[model samples]
Target: MAQDESLRDLYDGCYRRLVAQLYAICGNLGEAEDAVQEAFVRAVEKPRRFAQVDNPEAWLRTVALNVVRRRFRRLTRYRGLLRTAAASTPADAVPGLSPDHVTLVAALRQLPLEQREAITLHHIVDLPVREVALQLGVPEGTVKARLARGRARLAPLVREFAEDVEEVDHV
Candidate 1:
C-alpha cells in the first residue's frame, strides 16, 4: 500500500485501541492519548520503514509505550512539582474515567513497567503472546512469564476491586 493509504488504514485500525491500551498502561488518559498520537506521528515520518515492518499494530503499540515510559521518567525527575500540580488539578480537568476504572488503573501502575506492558498488550489490547513478544523484542516465553507474574501480582488487586463492586451492589 502507498504511504498515505497505509497511514490512513493504521489510524482507522489502531488509533482508539492504542489510546485505550496506553491508558491501561499509564493510568492517565491525556498522557495515553498524547503518547499514541506521538507514535502515529513518528510512524508517519518513517512510512516506508514502517510499511516494511512485519506487524504494524505491534510496532505502533511499542512506540506508544516507549513514549509514555519516557514521559513518565522525565516527569519523575521533577516529581515534587508534578505531584503538586497533579494534586491541584481538578478531577473534572482530567478525562472522565470512572472511580473503579481509576482504581484498576492505579493497580496497574503498581506493577513493574515490563509486567504492566505485558499484561496490557496481552489482555487490554488483545494481542497474542507471540505478537507481544515481537513488540517488546522478547521471546514468547518471556512474554508468557511476564504475563503469569503480572497476573499473580494483580490477582489480589482485581479481587479487591471486585469486592468493592459487590459491596456497592449491596448498598
Candidate 2:
C-alpha cells in the first residue's frame, strides 16, 4: 500500500509532462499517452526496481520512448497490410488528424527508416543533433547528413501541404 501510494504520487507528478514529451516524440497524443501509461505500469509492477532507480523521470522517459519505438516497428508491419487491404489512400485522415496533418504524416512515412527517425527526432521532437546521434547510436556527422537529406526530401512533400493551407486560408 505504501509503495502504491508513492507510485501514484509519482504518476500524478509525471504524467502530463511525460505525455507532452512523448507526444513530441511520436506525434500522436493517444500513442504518447498509452506509452506513458505502459511505462508507469511497469514501474508499479516492479516496485523494488523502481525504488532503486537513481532517476525515476529518466527511467520513465526511456521506458516510454522504448514503448513508442516498439509500437512504431509493429505498426510499420501493419501498414503494409493496411495498404494491401484498404482501398482508401493512405492519407485518409485518422479520426483526429486534420487533412494537412494526415498528408504530412503520409509524406514522412515515405522516408527511409533511418532518415525518418533522424528527422523526426531532430526536428519533430526538437532534440539537438548530438542528442539525436546519441539516441540513434550513430556519429554526429551521420545524424547531420540524415537531417540534410530528410529535409531535402521533406521540403517538396510538405510544400504541397503548405500550398493547400494557403488555398484554404484564402478561400
List model 2 lDDT by residue over 59-109, tens digit each: 887788789889888877898877764333444634665676566666776
The models' CA-based lDDT, in order, is: 0.83, 0.77
Candidates' RMSD to native:
3.4, 4.2
Question: All candidates' TM-scores?
Answer: 0.80, 0.64
Highest lDDT model number: 1
Distance (Å) between predicted and true CA of 48, model 1? 2.2
Off by over 4 Å in 2: 1-10, 24-28, 52-55, 78-113
Superposed by TM-score, candidate 1 places the C-alpha of residue 134 at a distance from the truth, in angstroms, of 2.0
Residue 130's lDDT in candidate 1: 89
**Model 1 residue pairs with clashes:** none
Q: Tell me how candidate 2 scores on lDDT.
A: 0.77
